[model samples]
Target chain A: MPEIIRFGDRGILVNFEQKIEAEINEQVIRLSEDLLHQHGDSLLYTIPAYCSLTIQYDPKRTNFKALSGSITSLLNRTTSPATSSHRKIEVPVCYDTTFGLDMVEVCANKGINSATLITEHTKPTYRVYMLGFLPGFVYMGKLSQSLWCTRRRDPRLLVPPQSVAIAGAQTGIYPSEAPGGWNIIGRTPLPLIQPDAEEPFLFKAGDLVNFKAISLQEYHEIEEQVKTGIYNLKVSYGF
Target chain B: MASSHLALYFAKPGLFTTIQDKGRFGFQAFGVPTSGALDQAAADLANQLVGNGLDQPLLEVTLMGPKIQFQGNGMIAITGADLSATLNGDRLAVNQGIEVADGDILQFGRPVSGCRAYLSVRGKWIIPTWLSSRSAITQNGKHLTPASIVQKGTTIRIDTSLVDPLRSSSAAIHPPETDPGIRVLPGPEFDRFSRFSIGEFFSRLYRISPDSNRMGYRLQERLSSFSPEEELISSGIIPGTIQITSSGQPIILLADAQTTGGYYRIANVVSQDLDILAQLKPGDTLRFSLTSFEEFS
Candidate 1:
């Protein structure tokens, strides 16, 4: 069972076990879908995090007491889980030194060679826990324990867009240039966010991701195709 | 359907000005910030004076107000901050509706008390809507508006065919005076903070740092005692969330704050007091007053 607590006066937070686990995040995502479909009219917005869902509601429409009660009853009466659509997205990444700014540092810190590092990094079928911190910036987790590394003491002022990076127990790609402390291990040529497109985000919560290692030549070719809007990301639905 | 005509021209854009509605809603899950008017009450009052809906898009002028030339005659109301505004060299008062003629230049001088002001013109704003809002935002290299910030020489269009002539004669109401202290409710992580840290948070006078922007306000002083043993995961946060940084500084997230952050949310400013913080300029000093949920309700 999760705890429904007051977040200020206008918001309510449904908090589960505080941790970064797939099962915990799955519940958050499910509840988010339920609220959007069921009680969205009363809600201003809902933010699904790793193990929590913060719901902002209009005080004029609904109050915390009534909304929390509704959420509690909804949680109690859940029949299986809200089966929403999910996707498994395959992203092509190049680990060439030109793009992987911190590859050597990561390899040295983990006491492994570049080849071993790439294999370990690409081995996991990471779950998309949530998208926050940046627009379309997918936060995935449970990287190979061997590759678990701390973020840099001094973060870079700007990490280039589509740079796949790892820090602590999580791995994600920077959708745009931002100040980040994660260790950059590869670069993906695909644009993860399209603000003006019909579907703005490339990845959403509850999606699965797999990283495929590519050569520098392939990276450039795909980059050109992406520039011309000819390349499409390989995606598998209903995972 | 009437075509919108150019209404206001920005001869010299202010320090920082942008279009804001109630907010960009239904997109926080995608990490989109709800960029809107920082001072909701002021924005609402300004719009009400012009007989416009509270959610109508308007300009939020910061620190210094803009030098605007009226391209078309319309009823306008200036509220929130007393920036010593004048129309064609004649002084104009806040919270009052003023009718303007074409080519009338409105200029703002030094800010008297507040950091931001609201400018509401009578009409439907002819602005691009992103995520179902006219609020302008520039995040992660992408802009919601054509230009990131309102630039000089820009023209704003509005449809004024439905303008209510009686709205310009609406009596002005006194805007609420901002309190010196901000009221706040304990956040989810408030219990984790040490007693001394909590005490200092409510007792000490903190000044708004110079680097404050639409995203959040950074305090000049750090809490004397604050060191948490655990790192908080990145979680959902909204405007008015007061997060304590690793360095013991408390940052008050504002209208354009990111949806999620990893810092400990020590407290959240009460919704009623959010307008007070919005009107406070950089270098302004204030203390926090702890208020319970029951008290706020």
Candidate 2:
């Protein structure tokens, strides 16, 4: 049974596990999607994380005891054994020295050359485990163990938008210029988040991402097209 | 047009000042945080005094206050911390609504108590609402990031025509001088820390760190450390979540905090006491007290 804990005055947290695991997050996503589909009206918002789902609601609409009752019932229901997405979209990256702010440090720390880092980083198709920290910022993970190292002791005060970064076992793209401590390896020209658009977020949790490297010249071409709103990134059917 | 009737030009943008409302909701699933006024009560009180709905957009001033020049006439109210506000060189009451004429300059003195202040004028604040909120939020709610803090010489328009000041009796809300114990519920990872860490958490008084801002308050003290675990998952975090970092220091997340986090959340401040947390200034000391979950209702 998922542990039901009080999040605050009007929210309940359903934790599926104590540690991070892909399977656990899959369960969390399923539960969140199921509950939202079943009782979204009663919910003010639902935030799904690696191993937990936090449901926030209005006290007037439904108190903790009442909300917990519904959540408990949903928890009793068995989560289907599977993944949320089979499709993987290709993401183009420019790993030039100018774009990769600390490519040397990451290469040295991980004991790999730039070629090996780029090849290994792009070799495996990563999962969109969750989106957090900022709008359109998707956290994907399980970078090869050899690539695993802690985040910077002192985070940069400013990391530009769409900068591809890795920290420890995870990787993410900055949707916007924000403070972060991740090891920057490359940058993408695509706008990963757009608040005013009909669909503000580009990558949803549970999706898969494939990285493709491009030259700096190609990066400029794509960037120019993006500026003119005339470019579209390649996304094909997956898994 | 009503928007033209109210224009604000800042002679001095003291500290951090920006527009805020109840915040954008229903966007957390997309990693967008609800960025609203840190002191909701103060924001509401200021709006109410000006005859505007409590959720309407208003100005939230942090630490220091802004110096504003009005282009037209309107009713206005200032609430929250006693910033010693003035209108056209005359002292303005903290919670009372007053009328202003064109060319009037609204200014503030140093803060007397509390950490934030709210200013509300009659009519809607005319600005683009990104994702249904105007709270210029992001980056720990510190006025440091350019996300929403108003810069000097910027003129902001508001839909306006002065309403007679609400004239209804407005209560002066001076915060209590007594140090408040922030009420909290045990976090999901409450027991994950050593028992000594938990005990130390309750017994110790932590001063707010200088780096603190709207994102979360970084506490000055360290506690018995929690061991590092590999593969910690990134997960949902909310305002009032007291997360302990690897450095053993605790950070109390507030409005504009990251949508999700990976640190161990040791406790959560109750909803009622969030306003108290919002009013905290750097160097101020605080301690936590556990409360029953039932108290949430």
DockQ of each: 0.68, 0.59
TM-score of each: 0.94, 0.92
Error of 2 at A220 (Å): 0.5
lDDT tens digits, residue span A1-239, model 2 = 78988887677888787665778778788878877887777787778887788778777766777778877876676655554445577889999989899899989887889999999899888888888888778888878777887898899999988999998788889988888899999998788865556776789887888999999999999989988888876776665
Distance from true position, residue B139, model 2, in Å? 2.3
lDDT of 1: 0.86
- Model 1 agreement with the true structure over B141-208: per-residue lDDT tens digits: 23445543578898888888765544444555444354378988889898899888898898898889
The runs of at least 3 residues in candidate 1 whose Cα sits more than 4 Å from the true structure, single-residue gaps closed, are A78-85, B1-4, B164-179
Stretches of candidate 2 exceeding 4 Å from the true structure: A78-87, A109-111, B1-4, B140-148, B161-169, B224-231
For candidate 2, lDDT tens digit of each residue in B1-297? 243478888889889888888977777877877779988888888888888877688888987888999888888888888888888778888888888889999999878888889888887676776776778875533422233568888788877763434545376776734457999989878878888889999999889999998888999998865565642466678788999998788999987888788788889898778888888899888889999876666
